[model samples]
Target: MQQLSKSHIPFFVVLVLCFTPWLQSPSALVLGLILSQLGWVPTNVPIAKWTKKLLSYSIIGLGFGISLSEAFKATSSGIGLIVTTIFVTLILGTWIAIKIGLDKKTGYLISSGTAICGGSAIAAVSPAINANANQTGLALAVVFILNSVALFVFPVIGHALNLDQHTFGVWAAIAIHDTSSVVGAAGAYGEEALRTATTLKLARALWIIPVALGSAWYFGKGKQKLQIPTFIFLYIAAVVVSDLLPQFETLYHMTFSVAKQTLVACLFLIGSAISLEQVKEAGLKPLLFGVGLWLAISIGTLVWLLY
Candidate 1:
């Protein structure tokens, strides 16, 4: 058998990953998980760290895509629902975790993901809570899997219920765990739904800052400084700059699209880092907790928002 060198394989994998045509977040997510399980890549590769940084950059790019003024208009209409659903989900998710004997940190991670922005929320809050990579991975896996299902399923349900574009957009923004899937589902519905959902979801994503600080306080033992997520501020700045610069609109849209694509690559990195040990650490309880909390937010919010 011929021996393959380490340097060449990763470069090729990365190249192919970069160019893969259908490399959306869900696909990238699946590919990453498969690679990790197969043990194809060595553990020493810094893709995980780099991917995390790329994700932050992607958020900044995401800001350029969303006009702050537009976001505020959408946000103003649904601010009460977004805020209430997030806090309620957080409290209920934590309560269920405690009731089921799940890890509190895991509960918080899952809840944060469900409440704010799926894997992005997990990424933002994990460091604040001092969660290990494996812990964050587990929470992300739970949320990512659900986001995939919701991406497709949500549209069907919306149509079945005959929800108006704005209503479905609000419902999706309130219910879906990840921004990508929330946008995906809404985009499937219509451009108006997509616009409304994206704006509302980004505004909802703004909650990550406070949630991270809250995590630091509640989970950390000693006195903790209020560590903020810097990327969020950059994200806001991008939104403002893009909105202000009329001539640069074309470039801004292109960059935002590139940012979303990079985020898919980031998902691949995140998926690759998920070890069996991490999955085992997650266990049945946390998964169940995720399921319960997701159902609560999905069903509960759907009823309240639609009616």
Candidate 2:
């Protein structure tokens, strides 16, 4: 029998890391990076091939985790703030990207990520806007890296300001770029904050459908007509099945738990794929554009939460 390849160790590490949220995903990313440098995994691995499929499946499974009633309540109460923030961030973020010399597609992709749910928003909007792989990768990289930062930083900011749990939850949900970061930051602050932020973030995620369509229309992809992602429908199905079968709450919870774990693995695979070329391709322009939108939502939501 052949001895086990030592290279499998980091791969195993990545496998373990993938089940976590942005809070832990960042660590996976950093470790993946270091392991890649050490030759534990080749930098040329085709991570995107499997990652896209797993990402969609994990998202669909995420529905099993969100109660429809809870999501609806969050939507009803936070819809105004969610809608306004998304719209403003998209328009302003796109404009900034253009002014800073990024392409229109990259600009729109980053804006969608920043305005909505980071990597998910960019993934959802990419097909509609006809974004190429490099464009989507750049957008995802920026949002993913910042999401890692936000996971740790937002909680510190919330505590420093002496904000209450409810206020911090809403602020995090409205401000942070990704659900995991929003949830992670708030979870650090308080349990109630976690519940509130998760509900609001899930509710905010529903905007992906409309935003995807809108990008298609505004960018001329509407000529091919709209095509919704099946994961979106599957996600809805997961929510319905979870709610209607309350007796299976135990099972649904289990399903969601597995899904979160899959997301952790997914992040690991994605993190391993980043390279110096991609970094050069991303450049400072998109980073600055993303930072602008990130700062905008962070400060803007805090102000709204306060008054």
Candidate 3:
């Protein structure tokens, strides 16, 4: 059996700190990134898989804190904007990618990610499009870099614009790449923003199914079976159960609190998965494509929200 070495110590230390009250989402992400950059992350652990599972569980747990009625309200109110932005981002992003001479598969993956739920969308679409490792990794790398930036930059922009909780929450859910970053940025903004963003983001995530299948058809791989994000159903169930069991309000609240901290840890795991090599592998055109597409969606959505 492989044993833990001195190099693994820093990773564990920072990981434990992620659960502490003082370390917030952005700090946890930065710490994890630092650990990876320093080569302190243990190679044995499946950090990416673990991050995905933990994030799913944390999202479901967060559902317990939300009222089913509010979830419905938030989702219903934002359905039009969510649908519109997803299609626009995908179309505009694809056009920009082709114009910039990026690889088709890589461009599509990045565009799907920006259009939907970031890494999740890319992961789902990659297999359908039969993207090779290099292509998939590059797409993920570009999205991750942008996701990290959004985590920090969105809140600052939100405050600078004096956006209210609802406006900022909507903007973050639409503009941010991944659900983790969306939750992190919105949570930092305020509790109302957190609730709004989480619900809207997950609602947006449902589009992954249709988008993935469409990608398979578009890529002439219609035989490929799509992996549905079943956790979304679990998340909805969590909200339902929480709403039905008000007698267990204390327990639900406790789970919600723990889940938020767990999400912080998930961000750390996600950050640890990123490396400089991945960034370098992403290359200039794809990175520029991602940044440009991200900027367009960010600004476009913010403008629509404001006006």
- Candidate 2 deviant stretches above 4 angstroms: 1-13, 16-23, 31-46, 103-106, 123-137, 148-165, 187-195, 213-223
Clashing pairs in 3: none
- Where does candidate 1 stray beyond 4 Å? 1-16, 19-21, 127-130, 159-165, 187-195
Deviation from native of the Cα of residue 76 in model 1, angstroms: 1.3
Q: CA shift at 301, candidate 3, in angstroms?
A: 3.9
**Native-vs-model 1 lDDT?**
0.78
Candidates 1 and 2 compared by TM-score, better number: 1
For candidate 1, write residues 1-307 as lDDT tens digits. 3344663375448536753556666667667777778766565567657766776787778777766676677678888988899899999988888888887888889999999989777876776676755666678778878888899999999999999998898888888998878988999999999888888897887777678777777875565555555776776688778888868998998898887777777767777777777687657877778888999989998889656
Top candidate on TM-score is 1
User: Tens-digit lDDT track for model 2 on 1-307?
Assistant: 3344767576775666566444355465566656655667643555677767776777777678777787788899988898999999988987777787888898898889888888777766775565655676667777887888899998888888999999989988888888878888989999999988888998888777678767877888536656555676777788888988889888888888877677666656655665657667767888777887899888988898788
Give the per-residue lDDT of model 3 (tens digit) for 1-307.
4567998998998888887788866577667777888988898888766776776677668778767665456669888998899999888877877887888888998999899888767655665566654566567768889999999999999999999998999999999998889999999999999988999987876676567667767777444654445665676688789888899999999998888788778767766877778656556988888898899999999889888
Error of 2 at 42 (Å): 5.8
User: Judged by lDDT relative to the true structure, which candidate is superior, 2 or 3?
Assistant: 3
Backbone clashes counted, model 1 = 0
> What residue runs in model 3 are displaced by over 4 Å at the alpha carbon?
75-78, 94-224, 284-287, 302-307
